[model samples]
Target chain A: MQLITVAGPPSSGKTSVILKLIEAMQIAASDVGVVKFDCLTSFDHLRYEERGIRVETGFSGKLCPDHFFVSNIEAAVEWGQNAGFKYLITESAGLCNRCSPYIHGIMAICVIDNLAGINTPRKIGPMLKMADIVVVTKGDIVSQAEREVFAFNIRQVNTAVQVIFVNGINGQGATILASHAAKARSIQTLRDLKLRFTTPAAVCSYCTGEIRIGNEYQMGTMKRMEFKKP
Target chain B: MNDTDILYMVLTVPVGEIMEKHPVCQNFFKNLRIEDIERGLPLHQALEKADPETLSEFGLDRHAIQREFCDFLNVFAGRSDATGPEITSITIIGGHGKAGDPENCQITINRGETISIVGPTGSGKSRLLADIECLANCDTPTGRKVLIDEQNLDDERRIELQGRLVAQLSQNMNFVIDLTVNDFLKMHAGSRHSINIDDTVERCFVCANSLAGEAFGLDTRLTQLSGGQSRALMIADTAFMSTSPIVLIDEIENAGIDRRQAIELLASRDKIVFISTHDPLLALGANRRLIIKNGRISRVITTSEEEKACLSEIERLDARLFQIRKKLRNGEIISRNALG
Candidate 1:
């Protein structure tokens, strides 16, 4: 089964896009499955269930959902395969701005809202730069000029990626998104699946639950941010 | 000779000083100038240079003394090791928590009982865990007083007890120490006074790998471990090596490890396990659950038989999820057959 990872910041219409894509894919008579990964709790799995598609949900609790999603993507694929699905779509709760859940050989889609500031695309880490497709949502809320600027900003970060302006609610651009997911390749081995970007170095003592505040006890790859004197 | 004997001897007096103070060994030291004796030679080395015949004449075997002295120095040079305490019960008395109602809350937890604390975000669940951890007595922000066995715990006693009272396994488990996995486990085992450090460390690694989604080698550096691997290691270590009777976990269900087995492993060890969670599977797994609303203990409910029945269904769903998770990690496709 082909795998498609849909990732973006919270409320970037990831589920809406997936739902519309699933509806479009059903029109073509292709079987689909979904796995939703979230940090706390989620209701997206219910939407897939309502559509009568095979679906599973995982809550990462206090852990990083992106890492959790990557670790469990295989099982999701197997579940889809057992049901004879042609495509398996996975959605990750992109809590960490720097984390990239996309894997090589899969159709990695990064959805961004036009209202999330034009600089958001630039601020996004490998998740945006490495994505095969960048879907700009909430175009209805922004003007034509603002939408163009948002798309332009995304291009500045990833010149090679295909940028699509999608209205997730009305099913606009869902056909193209569905076609890309349908044609995506499945990775044969995890070794073949490479990350497009490097992970941010873990340097915070708080990362290890170290409550003490001081540079002497701080360890790992740490960077100090200097404040400008006013 | 035993380690304690060596410790006693070295700590009591220097070997050169001991020899000098004793009249019986004065002649033996005569061959060595007073200046040489006065110049501090390590006790073990000073004993090494003494003549065997002379030592024998004084009713002391030179080789035996040298071996004993070496053993003593080894013990002296090694880091100190300690064991955890045997905690029977924990009691929490009411104080005004940051978010919880100011009403005093009174609750007591006993050994071998698993309790889950559930609340919305910023509901003071962690504050309660912290109160239990610190054995607090009105000093913390929550104003919650913790008692070990119906009596208020002394702050000094809490400091002296080490990991005997609580061993916390928080959400983030990053290993800052730059050591091999085997070396890290070995060090932990050594500190716990394991009889066979190597064997214990091996057991820990095996147990950790069983819980972790990915299998890691003993040669892997601690710093290189992923979030799931580190959590698995910490769980295994806490279950086997840690002497802490009460295990406070912020959340174990998040990192893609086998959460069910991790909880079962800790619970089976007769520990008082308290987990703060948002998942129903983990919440219902506990014998009792403390519902935290606005930071106070709004209500405590025992797991009803109906809930226990629901747990079986939840377990089935959780098991299916776990199977899919495992297959996914192995680079397998999710087929309909995988649901079975």
Candidate 2:
């Protein structure tokens, strides 16, 4: 099955983009399954179910949703295959800006809204940088000039990635996305698919449930943030 | 020569050479005794007759000194220096919370009870967990007051006994350290003053494997571990090694480990468990569920027997999903019939 990972910041229209793509794929006679990964609770699965699509939801309560998604990805793929689906689409919880849920040899899409800000592309970590396609959502709300500038900022960070402007509410540009996903080459050898970007190094003591605050007892990969004097 | 000359020569001779030259000298060196060529008593008897002060000056108490050294070594190796506090319960008083409505709420959680907080995103479910972690006394944004055994805990004591009072497991379980799994556990075990470090490390491994889908060896670097494995390791370490009386879990549903087993492990240890989650399985698993809205506690619902019964159905569905996931990871094609 063709696996597509949809990731972006919260309320960046990831779900809307996926929904529109699913609709377009359905019209083209493609069977698809969805796995929604959220940090706490999610109602996205219900929407998929209402459409009579096979869907499963995972809540990564105290765990990073990306990590949770990777752990259960195989199970999701199996579920998709069991249902004879042509595509398996996953929606990740956009909690950690630094984390990238994309895997190698898969169609990785990162959705961002024009309203998020033009510089959002620069601020977003690897999720936007490593995506194969950057889908600009809420394009209908922004002026053509604003859309151009947002697209330009995205290209500045990732020169090779394809940028697609989509209005998920009315299914604009979804046909192109669905066709690209449906016709994309399947991964030749899934044996050693690695993530496109390295996960941000986990150096903070908080990462390990450490409660003490001090430099002496701290151990691990640590980063210090510096504030410039105004 | 006189007897004094003989005595002086015996005392001046190096002990090693003297023992080698005169095998009898090995036992008789306690004090100098002139050889009476023909009438001298045996060396052993001669040493017995020597003065105690002379023996002491000759450094003949080597055996006693060696014994003391061994005793000191034992003391150094056998003692456990680590200690932790034993808390019985955690009580939340009717302090005003900083969420949807500014209302006072009170809840007392005893050891071995599991409580879950549920709310929409940005609704303050996490705020309550934070208040408890900080041992708030209406001073923080949430205006929640936390007590240990129905007594207010001071800030100094809280700082002094941070990890002992509560161990929080947040959503991120990333390891920044480059050490191997074996080294990481060893460091934790040493800090905790574990009596049997090797045994504790082994137990942690077994427990982590039980919760994680994939098995990782002790030699695997912490950075190389998958997300689920890291979470599993932390959970096992907290449940088994940490002496904390309360465990605050941000969410474990997406951690890729066995969420149910992890919860059961912590609760079985008599820890007062507070989990903030949006998952139904976790919410229903708790004895009581606190609903959070806007940033305050709106209602508290005790899990009904009907919900408990529904949990089994949920578990079954979860297991089915897990099985399918496993098969897919193994590079097998899934068929509709396989789901059955």
Candidate 3:
């Protein structure tokens, strides 16, 4: 039930970071699952067919984005893990940083495109402060001085957070960022361990329509549960 | 368990493309307070940006909206609900270039109900069903007004509500993909929102096969199903919906199912059920019967001594007419019963 959410501004390499992570995981023989909590994008579900990823876009008449992302991201992560994915990468909607790191205890990676300049950090100050990893994407587009200043300012807001440059085209600096992310813990996964509804009557805390009253393994480890009860 | 959803298993469909293909869906969006395409909101954020003021202003009721939307979608391929009808009105602005008798017509089944809409072929019986489903799903008459319990349904919410509150069973029950009986039930159950799966599955088995889950041995595709089995399967699917309160059934008699069993199922429920048929058995069983003649609800009989007598006489005349038509087709001369 661990969820690692990838957050960033639109067109700033958030999708790229997740795709690369998935590729590296597959290359390393690790099964990874990915889901997108999109706010402004729409497409056919089959686009994810090649990778075996399942997408569940938020429907109209449901709640707002902030609430949907946190809840839906949690559901997707749980579903993937149950399906035996070794890791789960969630791509968050751009322009919605208020609830970016708000997911209860997952490592949040904020992609800051260096080519976009220093103002990028200022526009996303709150997200950077909450991020566990601040990736300076499009590193080739920025001067070394600009990278240093960017990291320096980012480190000031969250001194313990890791900052690195990523040249997605050449695979430069991605290894370091990936390694840091690998060690980060997921709060949802940790909290999930405390669940002890020893009976068949124990409804899932995440999705109430499904209840776990006994020891059984479903196709997707996570039981198919509906949020809206009949 | 939340890990899988986080991994972004996407179920995205091009909203604009689908909306374009099914313009009536745009009406569903309009009902949600977004009338113009310029709002250009993506499907994921449609509910978020839905104008609350517009929904209220339109005076749309929530339950009806949910039911009608679900009803419309149930008409698609592999999505029949067979549960019965939910619509109150299906007003065609102009008949498909056929000379029009009525501009708008309403077909409704009220609460505590059993009812049927009866008509001759080309009398708009099937057309009425299709139009009702189109209106429910926001599919036809692009941007037209089709009300459920009198509240207007727009396209966005209509699609959202379609599966949850209304289910339909079309006449031509055919499938391209072969599936076992259980597979058919399971696929449909997954799409709906609120039913206890185990309980619903159990009930479905009982109704479908007239036996419990383990005892029901038949498991085959639509092509293999006898008229009775196919009709029963559809009925089970519709009756099982925890979402649709209004079930629209189009000519249950066409499948050669046991009419008594179907009637019993509808009679047992409190929800509205509308069935369109030519069978006298179904027509007489209805709580209300609307005789659609020449594409209009020419007469409605809820219950009066004279109305009851008139219906019985009409049924008699209908049976005689059917025999006469059959004999004439065979080139036989008219009999005394035919003349009467």
Candidate 4:
């Protein structure tokens, strides 16, 4: 099955872009399935089910969404294969901008809206840096000059990646994104696959449910801010 | 043969032989409403033999008609690429957008055509022109490749080819050279090895003056030319002196030149003209217009015959505006009725 992963900040139109891509692909609902990974509650699977497409939604709850995504993505791939899906898509809301759930050989997309300021491409961290394609959403809402400037900023962060403009509301550029996404090399399993970037690290005292907010409570993998001397 | 020889031959030869040899000349004849040339009569004789009523009906003089026919031949021959490899079309391969998205657009512009690039400000119109100007082979930031004759040129070939293919008149054009206009034209004509230097100089000078708002003497320094004057000067220079086959003009609408004639002059000389314009007249007048969005060509619209039919009305309106501009320059007060 072709593996496609969509990662972006919240409300950047990742789910909408995925929906448009699925529609543009014109595949049978039974042949494709989506695995939605978000932080808290997500009703996106209902949207997918409403379209008669199979979808599995997993919430990380208090855990980092991307960490949960990386850990269970293999199972998601296995589920998709058992379901006889020709295309398997996984989406992660890269909440912290610290991680993106991309595999070594899969089609990775980072969706960011034009409303996210001109410097957003650089601020999004590896989520923008490691993707094979960066789809800019909400192009219809901005001026042509603003769009050009936004695209220029993305080029500054990652020079090798392809930049595309998509209007998620009307699904204007979905077919093009789908065609690029369809070119993902098929993989039988994610067991031997490697992550494009290591997921956000750190197992601090908060991990063990310490609930303390003191510097003394701060533990593993923590960096303290250094104030200039008075 | 050179243009003069061809012109002489066409004028001296029988109209039947000229038509049979160059079938394309039929278009010129048809446009001028010159029908029913006798089998034995030459083109000069055919026009002379025609009644004055027919010539006046088409609003064409005999000598001007012959010159126009020659101009048509020159443009037709340029499209045929009589000299070397045929650059029949300009193909722009898909390139990524600014946001690292793949721009899945393939645009091919044929020779002897006028195209307009239109979009809102900061839409990368100039950037697209730059891509074509450099003949980018995925090395530019946009990763757009411009192909000539549908083949991508390597870096070495692009470097070697250089400015031989495209002569672009950018928005901010300043001539820093210290030479007089007469000296500059003579120098260019000298470099191009023109057979009739005086004739070319006169043609270029008159063409520039006709296009510009105010006329400047040939002895005027190049740096002393105004924005409109310099723009007009380059338009004339690009038409007469520049050897490049492709021409790119950025924002010519505000250049204060005779827009239609400027385009026609270049196009008639076998130059492929691409103008980045915001004016509806220039855009609609083009054979095709590319809509640029977010630094990529979002769409290409070929000017339909129906769209072309609207141009005459636009041209008329533009002419009215031109008159008002003239009156305003003469310090005439703007009366309410004069707005029409």
Worst 10 residues of 1 chain B by lDDT: B26-35
Writing each residue's lDDT as its tens digit, candidate 4 over A7-34 gives: 9998899888988888767788899999
Candidate 4 per-residue lDDT over residues B55-135, each given as its tens digit: 653335778667756765565532432232346888888798778778888977777789899998888887787677656
TM-score of chain B of 4: 0.70
Distance from true location, Cα of A221 in model 3, Å: 38
**DockQ score of the complex predicted as candidate 3:** 0.01
TM-scores of chain B, in order: 0.74, 0.73, 0.53, 0.70
Return the lDDT, model 2, position A110: 91
RMSD of each: 27.0, 29.0, 25.6, 24.9
Could you give candidate 3's per-residue lDDT for residues A86-107 as a string of tens digits? Answer: 6677766544433343443567
Candidate order, lDDT descending: 4, 1, 2, 3
How accurate locally, in lDDT, is each candidate?
Answer: 0.70, 0.69, 0.52, 0.76
lDDT for position B216 in model 1: 97
Give model 2's TM-score for chain A to 2 decimal places: 0.89
After superposing candidate 3 on the true structure, give the runs of residues whose Cα lies further than 4 Å from its correct spot: A1-230, B1-108, B136-145, B154-165, B175-177, B193-195, B211-223, B303-340
Retained native contacts per candidate, as fractions? 0.00, 0.00, 0.00, 0.00
The C-alpha TM-scores of every prediction are 0.48, 0.46, 0.36, 0.49
Candidate 3 residue lDDT tens string, B1-340: 1323211211133446546644435544543435553334434444345545444433334443333333332332123333434543333232321344443434455554766788787775654544444343222322123456656666465543432344455455433335666665554453332235456666776786751111233366645666556667667655654334655676656454556566657556654667887777677767677666665556667755666676677656655665676688689998685677
Name the best candidate (by TM-score): 4
Interface RMSD of every candidate?
Answer: 30.2, 28.9, 28.7, 23.0
Give candidate 3's error at residue B232 in angstroms.
0.9
- Span of ten consecutive residues with least summed lDDT in model 2 chain B: B30-39
- Tens digits of per-residue lDDT for model 2 on B1-340? 2444434434454434434543323212221222222124323333444455433432234343223222322222233434446677787764554433565578888999999999988887765765675566665555667788778777566544432366667664345546788887876665455778899899988999999999999999877988899889888888777767788888778777899889999999787889999778888999999888767787889999999999999988888888888899999899997777
